[model samples]
Target: MEWGMHGWGMGLIWVLVVLFLVLGVLAFAKYLIKG
Candidate 1:
């Protein structure tokens, strides 16, 4: 049970990191276009 929970937590962190990176790229592109 503990191992399963640990794995799930890691997966969630990875998902958040990926989402943050994608958003950062999109924001940078938008800034360049507006500038």
Candidate 2:
């Protein structure tokens, strides 16, 4: 298990990507509901 700083950064990026995807889905749903 040689995972160091690089692995940590990758994990953080994955979390951020997932967060953005969830936010995008919620925003689209809200737009649909409003329109």
In terms of TM-score, the best-performing candidate is 2
lDDT per residue for candidate 2 within 1-35, as digits (tens), equals: 67999899999999999999999999999999999
In the predicted model 2, the residue pairs found to clash are none
Once fitted onto the true fold, the runs of candidate 1 whose alpha carbons sit more than 4 angstroms away are none
lDDT of 1 by residue, 1-35 (tens): 57698899999999999999999999999999999
Candidates in order have lDDT scores of: 0.96, 0.98
TM-score of each: 0.84, 0.89
